[model samples]
Target: MREFLQRTLVWLIVILFIGLAFWAFSGPIEGLIAAGVALLAWLGFHLYHIALLLRWLEQPTAERVPDGFGAWHTVFMTLYRTMRSQMQSKRKLTNVLERFINAGEAMPDGVVVLDENDRIEWINPMAMEHLNLDRKHDVGNQILNLIRQPSFHAYMKNASFSQPLVLQLTQPRELVISVQLVPFDSTRKLLLSRDITSLERVQTVHRDFVANVSHELRTPLTVVGGFLETLSDMEEVDQATLSHFLPMMMEQSRRMQSLVEDLLTLSRLENSPKAVMAEKVNMQDMLDTLMVEAEGLSQGRHHVRLEKGCNQWLWGSAQELHSAFGNLVSNAVRYTPEGGDIVLSWKAEGERLCFSVKDSGIGIPREHIPRLTERFYRVDRGRSRGNGGTGLGLAIVKHVVARHNARLDIRSEPDKGSTFSVIFQRERSAEPEAQPENQA
Candidate 1:
């Protein structure tokens, strides 16, 4: 309002000056004629300035503001400054928006922005993968139409986002995705999704492990309790009956002891951050001791042979390797029949050195081969228990091999035979160092 008044005052002063100059120059008639001419000239000048202002307004970005005299000059400068300030602010906002988008793209979890109608406005790459969505083509499409899971549709309609929904997809692989929606602004929604399949598997394994441990312990405890009750109840039992019962009790006690020891070994292997012992282990000597132990376990049932094909000794914890190799030999003796052949071979295949136990035992089915290393996972539970197997031998072997950067391979066919091989990398194999007699 002040600017308007100032402009009005300036125009009035110009008119008054023209009147006074005409009055001072000539008489009333001449003065009036001159005044009319002067007013026309002023009108033409103002008209030209109006045309420039109109052109500037039409293309403010293309044309610069017109330089004007007096109040017109002030008006042009004010509009120009305001427009420039607004442009600068808009540029800053655009830069900030671009940075926000980049950060969202880099996130591990999926992020999706939706409008009031649940139409996908924008989605990151992770969302594209999780939902199998094509951002380029599927944008502006309703999320419900694409991800047509019944649970997700129901959840969307309910508009309750306090909890997340887990969606299981079975197309490419068995994937578990956790999804949640957050309402922001007035009608905008933000959808978040994360792959939680690994977490879910771990939880399942933990539950199964606890249940298996309980089941294993319960059987032994029940047997021990029943026998103790029987012995206490029968005060005058015969010597032969007592001797049979005592051996049975001792066998169950030994089984329990073995189970407990294996569980402890597993616990220690998991808890230890790194291998504790680093020494040159003589593979030939290790196999020699293992053969002796295997023979005792076999009780002249299976023909055991040791074929040392490689002189490359192992460099690692001797105790861990022994426990691993010993388990393989023992398992072979336990599983192989009376006349079956068990061949323990240590040889170099290419750059990898392998210690394998091949047995002509009751072979495993194809379906059960993948889970052989799992704790307490047996192909035949009754047969394993009858053979005095604690079900944790292969699980221990797996951990030991992993610690030494080795791989365990199992090849088997039902009714044929099975071969279990532990392949160690060449870097892990070392030449046996010479002993110095002076120290002795």
Candidate 2:
């Protein structure tokens, strides 16, 4: 306002000077001088009036009614600039929203959208797969009612009007879903859901395995200790009976030892970071040693052969790869029929270095195949214990493969046989080590 008043004063003075010069040219010298003085007084009067007008124009239209064209100009330009800024902000927000929509739909997991009223608004491709949602019916429907889960329904009904609600999926399988509600305003809400089923399943399995293994080992250990105490108080027991008891005690101790060692190894793998500084493991050397060890364990009854064609080295911890490959190969030898042929093959498939241990064994059922890697999850518990299987080979294999940033594929059919494969990323050439035949 001060600036506008100053500009007006300057423009008004310039106009007065021009007017006086024009009027002075048509008069006598004394008269022209007098007219010039009159013009300066006229200029001051006009300048004061313009100043008052500009000050009134600059007053906020919301507080004062604009009474003239001059005042209206100020109000109109102020509103236009404010509207322009608001429009630009909305455009930027829309761009961000569009990008979020595209990224959310592209996700591999399920996603659902909800309006402020907790009604379904949108769903992603993955939501269609996991939820079996029919868009035509699901859209515009209340989310809690559509799911039809009592717990979820109650949760949403009593949900905090301003926050999110979480519900577990207790349907086809036990799945954990974290549902988040983003409230833009009291009348707007966005729902985001993430599937944590696999994570929760892993946690449950870990807990159950620990409890089961502890019980299994402790029971046998207690019995063996009791037998040793009885042996010490043998006042009339036969030596044959004592001898028989000793072997059983020794076998039980060995089983306990194997279980403890495998548990420790699994613990290490799990506690450590998933990504380690991967070193190049010579694929040929790795398989050759595994086959040799496996053959020795088989006592030459089951011939283990290695087919090596992968020039690429494996990119991971050599020790981890050895353990992963060794477990798979040795597991095959243990399960395969006597005198059966076990083939260990390695080749490069795309970016992955693939290795497989194929054996003629009692194959696993389709349902059990998914969980065979779980600790102590035996297809035949009696046979497994009788064969001196600690029931941790597959579990160990799983952890080792994960440490190596590799994938384990278990393909088997009933009675035909099973093939366990580990797919590893190819690495740069590694320094040559002892040929892939040494087992130490």
Candidate 3:
């Protein structure tokens, strides 16, 4: 409005000046003619500016706004300011959206976005992996169609978001996922998925451990209770009967005691902080003691020999190493057949010091090797029990090895032999003359 008024005012001034000048030299009719000519020229000037405005409007950028004379100058400047402000606001919004997408991609858990009609809108990389979805092809498709699990379909249909659903997916990999749906904006929903396979495995192990413990205790308890009941019911126990049952009861009682002790040792190793490596263990003396224990356990059934390749001492808890090594030797002694060769060695290979037990025993199958360190796991349950094993030796050995920063390697072939080795890093072993600083 202001520009229009300004132009009108200028036009009137031009007409008046031209009219008066012509009137002074000529007549009123000639003055009227001059005013009309001035009006035409003024219109032409306005038309030129109008054309420039139209050309600039096609692109309508701040940088391309045309400069104008008189009122059009104000019009062009206003357009420039407005256009620049809008561009800045748009750039900020774009940055914010980019940051949001980047955060979604970086998240560890899977995130899937659904539209009002339950169509796939956006999904993070983790979501793509968890759902086995191709982002290019899966986007804009119905989420239910892609995930056709009946439970998941029912979960979506029910719209109950209070509890998460546990889904076992077999595509891409066998995965146990805990999924939850969250509603937002009165129309859209967020589907969140978390991998819980490890958690499920732990729970299963816990249940199995409880059952095994109960079963182990029940057998001994039943034996001891039955013998006691029989002795109590007798009026006068004969000498032959007493002799027959007493030793058997004592053996079962000892077995139970051993099991309890092993359980305590394993629990301590697992719960305690890393073992103190301050004590310097004499490897030669330790191996000799293990030789004596192996002979005592074998009772001339197997030939046990010690091989000391290096007399280097180790920097670790002597008691823990003794227990770990003793378990290995005892296992070898018990498993080997009569006259079988059982070798216990403290040797160096490359940059490591290894204490290994090799035996000519009925070796374990390949399938059982991976789970040998699991508590109470056995290749043959009856044979292991007959040999008086608590089934916690390897588990204890594993914990001890981990505490000492060592690795346990097991190699075996059926009917050939088996070797169990605990390999320690070079830093753990030192010569007699140069021992490491005590790090208690």
Candidate 4:
């Protein structure tokens, strides 16, 4: 509006000056003619500016705005400023959108965006892997056609997304995904997916653990109950019957007790914090004690020997190490046949120290080696039970080894022998104790 007034005032001034000049130099008729000519010239000037404005509007960029004279200069400058501000706002919005997309790409969970028609608008990298989607090909396609799960299709069609959908995918590897739909922008939706495979596995392991514990206890309880019932029924029992039933009941009771102790040990190891390594374990004494225990457990069946190749003590809990080492030694004695060799050795290899039990026992098969550390896992269940094994020995050993930052290696051959070694790193081995001074 201001530019319009300025243009009108300029035209009136030009006409008035031209008319006054003609009136002073000539007459009234000549002055009127001069005013008409001035009006035409003023129209021509405005037309030329209009042409420049129209040409610049073809591109409509701030940099391309044409220079103008008189009122048109102010109009061009205002137009340039408005265009520049809009461009800056557009660049800012573009940057924010890019950041949002980058965040989705970096997230561990999957994210998918769907338009009003349930067509794929954008999908993150994880979502592509979870749903088997191609960014180039799958975009703009209906998500239902790609997912193809009946439950998922029904979920979208119903639009009742109160609960997340648990989907088990077989292709692109077996995966368990928790999928949820969140509506946004009144029409569009965000599809979120999280991998819950590990959680599901843990829950399955918990259920199996409970079932196994129940099954293990029931047998011993049933045996004890049966014997008690028999004793009660027999008012005058014979000495032979008493001798047969009493020992059997005692053996089952002892077995149950062992199982309970092992379970408690495992629970403590799992729940307790790391073992304190301030106490230095005397490896020589510990190895000697293990040898004696192995011999006792052998009962003059297999020959047991201890090889003390290194005098270095260990920096760890003495009680836990004793338990771990004893378990391995006893297992060797129990499994080895009569006249077999059982050697318990403590030696240093380079910067590491190793405690190994090598026995000529019924060695494990190759396939069972990987799962030997799992609780209640036995290569030969019947043989293991006959030998009075609790099946939690290796699992306990594994935990103890881990607590001390050590590694347990097992090597075996069928019917030949098996060697179980616990290797401790340099950090775990302490220097040999100093000898007494000459003064004594």
The prediction achieving the highest lDDT against the true structure is: 3
C-alpha positional error of residue 109 in candidate 1 after TM-score superposition, expressed in Å: 1.7
lDDT of 4 by residue, 1-440 (tens): 58868788977997999998998899988998998888888889889989999998788998998898778888888888999999999999999989998899999999999999989999999999988899999999999999989988888877489899999999798999999999999999999999999999888878877877787788889999999999999889999999999999999999999999999999999999888879988787787788789888998998888888889999999988998999999889888889999999999999999999999998989999999998888898878878888888999999999999999999999999899999999999998686568722
User: Cα deviation of 256 in candidate 3 (Å)?
Assistant: 2.3
lDDT per prediction? 0.88, 0.74, 0.91, 0.90
Q: List the residue pairs that clash in candidate 3.
A: none
Candidate 2 lDDT, tens digit per residue, 266-383?
8888888874655756676676688779879899788678787655665567886687778887788878888787999987787667889999888888989988998888898887
Best-to-worst ranking by lDDT: 3, 4, 1, 2
Candidate 3: residue 395 Cα off by (Å): 1.1
lDDT of 1 by residue, 226-282 (tens): 988988898788999889888888888888999999999999998897564368898
lDDT of 4: 0.90
Error of 2 at 385 (Å): 3.0
Model 3 C-alpha lDDT per residue in residues 370-436, reported as the tens digit of each score:
9999999999999999999989999999999999999999999998889999999998986765435
lDDT, residue 132, candidate 3: 94
In model 1, what are the clashing residue pairs, if there are any?
Answer: none
Model 3: residues with Cα > 4 Å off, grouped in runs: 1-50, 238-240, 433-440
